[model samples]
Target: MPPIRTFTAALGLAAMTATLLVSAAEAAPRNRYVQVQGADGRGYVASRNAHRTSSSFTANRSIQTNGGYGLNRNRSAAYGEGSYSGSSQTVFNSGRSINRSASVHDNGDGTASYQRTVTGSEGRSRSVSGSVPYTPPQ
Candidate 1:
């Protein structure tokens, strides 16, 4: 090649190399991190539920000299609990069943109180309560 052509070719190649380096640097990736403000506690829990139910019918034809009684009960109840807290908690529940119906006789004390509850399935029932009564000074 001629001297002028050789010098021009070298200059062009140098310019191309400089441009490739500049573009490579500019195209490289960069990372960023976020800064958090003041806070306390961590994590949470949540849930929901729904249900529907129905019952059927029945009939009987009989006669007894002694006595006869029939009772059909239909009851439905739904309960929900909501706890919005950052603290951890543990829970447990239990229940049972005992039914009896015959020549019924009820007796009550003057200062007595009664309570009734029902449970699903054959589970057991358990409850705990705390009480403190005041004492009069002599």
Candidate 2:
């Protein structure tokens, strides 16, 4: 009877430790910014921010130069309940840009469907979509 009680206590302690470990792994949001300039008045500035969780994440970045050139980009995604969706876009000061998006959903029959699209800087767009068998990671 003593051995049985000891085993049970050890199991309970292990469960609690596992829960705390999982909680500690969740990270907080982060942000960064930087700028540089020279005596010649030529310089650039940049910034980035990001956040993440057990199921979702989002991020963006931007850069600007003193020569009238600039760039911006953004992306985000989330997954849960057998589905996922994400999109991204990038643009430049010269009117050139690219955009993309994708989505996937489980069919509940051991397969999943997906769709994706991409648009280039010249405004020409292309898309490809298909389905495949899905196996969730253990």
Please tell me which predicted candidate would have the highest TM-score against the true structure: 2
Off by over 4 Å in 2: 1-27, 38-42
In lDDT terms, which candidate is top?
2
- How close is each model in CA RMSD to the real structure? 40.5, 14.2
Give TM-scores for every candidate, taking all chains together and pairing residue i with residue i: 0.17, 0.71
Supply every candidate's count of residue pairs whose N, Cα or C atoms clash at under 3 angstroms: 7, 0
lDDT per residue, candidate 2, 79-130, as tens digits? 6666667778999989899999866666778766666678998889987666
lDDT of 2 at 112: 64
Scored against the true structure, residue 13 in model 2 reaches a CA lDDT of: 31
**What is the lDDT of every predicted structure here?**
0.24, 0.70
